[model samples]
Target: MGKKYSDIKEKLQIVVDKKTTNDLAHLTHYFQNHKNGVSQCFRSSATEYLSELHEELNIAEEPNFQYYLPIKWDIPFPPTENPTFKFIDLFAGIGGIRLAYQNNGGKCVFTSEWDTYAKKTYEANFGEVPFGDITQISEKDIPDHDVLLGGFPCQPFSIAGVSKKNSLGRKHGFLDETQGTLFFDIARIIKHKKPKAFMLENVKNLVSHDKKKTFKVIISTLEKLGYNVHFKILNGKHYVPQNRERIIIVGFKKTVFKSKETFEFPDPQESNFVFKDILEPKVDDKYTLSDKLWNYLQEHARKHKAKGNGFGFGLTDLNGISRTISARYYKDGSEVLIPQKGKNPRRLTPRECARLQGFPDKFIIPVSNNQAYKQFGNSVVTPLIQAVAKNIVKELSKINESNQSKIAVHK
Candidate 1:
């Protein structure tokens, strides 16, 4: 016969006293009244008591203890079959692309973003911190993925930059700038990974940056790397309440490329929102603009209006669309101004800023209001990305089906 209850209890008590004093004392008190000696009956009761205690504590049994483990409730593992297509998010920002793809049944295998604040927000929402500085990472170190997505830095090719390329022949297209020239890193990775597809986002100016030369170079580069590239300018107002405009570029690996499909960017939906849509009804003193600054803006707008120039700030109405929200919005409330009851114009609150960019309320905004403004201003509109991703997935599925048919015939 196996060891008796009382005998096991005595041995366990010695072990417990040495390893866990307080728990042993309490356990011994509960079993102290049992009259059975070191016999099978005592051993059976000790096992039951310990098992019940384990249950109450919600502790997982060690794998080595499986043979002695008692029956208990089990947690169902998440289904892995028919798993979603996996992609990596480069220059992830706040995971705008990741959110878009995830909503469409795609999974993120890896993400990289250098900004610490954006990474914090990305982790808060996606439960994963993005790796930093893509340029420092090796191509071989990246995991295998079917898709690659990024809104790589746009500063090098932005209208604000000097020595900008004016054509595909110029090196300044993306490879020449030192401050924010990271696109070639993306090119190298794509050359090696040969993902089925990739999507890139940038400012609208990128298309016309250098008399169409910049855009031409990008398209030709991807072609040389064996990809069928398609690109278009998409507006956020089409999918959200904001009037932000951006360029979306997509490509399919040359090996998997097929007959081109018409890439229709989603059209703007009827939006009834104005600057008022993102305003706070109750004004906080912190948000109230200084009378001096307000006077300066008003005078500046008047001067610009006199010159027939729309370059200066203007008060937006409650029923009209807003001007584009720029990264410089943090500097002054000049781009999009709101009409106030008796106070000066105020900048949009961080929450309102997030909403303007089509960020869901569940999205985390863990940074300061200024950082939030910059982040959303830089992020791609989620809905627009989703619409474009849908088209890419559709085209890829067709290619995959064709390949399957060919395989079947050969077999």
Candidate 2:
């Protein structure tokens, strides 16, 4: 049985003092029922106690904290007195990042994607198809925009590719791999256009890729391009019900705005999401795997267990978050297995896959189930992107306000 409220309170008081009787009551109830673990309970209780302390001390809220609260990082940017900031979507896989920025009142001046099927889905939803082959298109051909966004290809730096490339004796850095070389294209565009800011997303392994040399080069190259670079590893589980980790890099054009301080990534919000919250009750029969495949998976699990490698598919319960979905999900749905009744395990429907990535029901999926699975598995979480975009807009607003103030002083 769980500990009683009074016993828990007594234990908590040793670390947290100065709580009123009413505050303690609320905190005790919170701990007994909250979905998160003790750490969350402690953090929430501490926050509530701190607020009360602030009132007692007559201290004002910090400027950043005041601005941070109540701003739904998940929602798009609020309308501004300044005209809507323009942004371009690069490597726009089905426009996940594009939707986040668009929801925030930012306009897309250009979009680029090389995948034909992804282009179809993107156009079906966004009303305009992305131009093909960013490598072929010059920076001058692209329209001017305040921001740039992309989750560049991750194949080259991935463990799978590194192993293959090392055997071939080809160059291993970003410049050698087909997808790795694309960063040069992004850097060249930034050098020429100098957008107010840009955001790049990639797998978390990118930080430690090639024993840190790969990351060091990326940083130094962007710095030479005259931008202040900031990066953080953000997890999708914080905003959505999936455990996907990615590195987000934000760069500010030094000529437009100069700041010595680093940008702070948004704090993790309370997550109430679960697998059941996104599942489709009446999925098509095609998504259900056959008994033969199910048996194979069980046998695979046992074999891998003997060898000490995890070969079995990961099964996510209705009450918990999901593991990361990958492009190979279409080939074998091995990463995200759903439970079935007295039968073989099943794969999530295409629509369920979309929901896992935070795509709304209204977002059209014009491709085949296999294609849909691959696309969403490769996409970003809209809420996560939207929240980070909000922070970027806030910083840009400051720069705009500062410019106006300087003009007024001159007058």
Judging by TM-score against the true structure, name the best candidate: 2
RMSD of every candidate to native, in Å, equals 14.6, 20.1
Q: In candidate 1, what are the lDDT values of residues 274-350, reduced to their tens digit?
A: 65666656756776678888888889888988999766875666677677776667777677777677777777777
Write down the worst ten-residue block by lDDT for model 1: 71-80
Q: TM-scores across all candidates?
A: 0.74, 0.77
Pairs that clash in candidate 2:
76-104, 77-104
Q: Score candidate 1 by TM-score against the native.
A: 0.74
Q: List, residue by residue over 134-243, the lDDT tens digit for candidate 2.
A: 89878876556799888888877766556678898766557674688898888888888889999999888888998988888988999999988999999989888899
In model 1, the number of clashes is 10
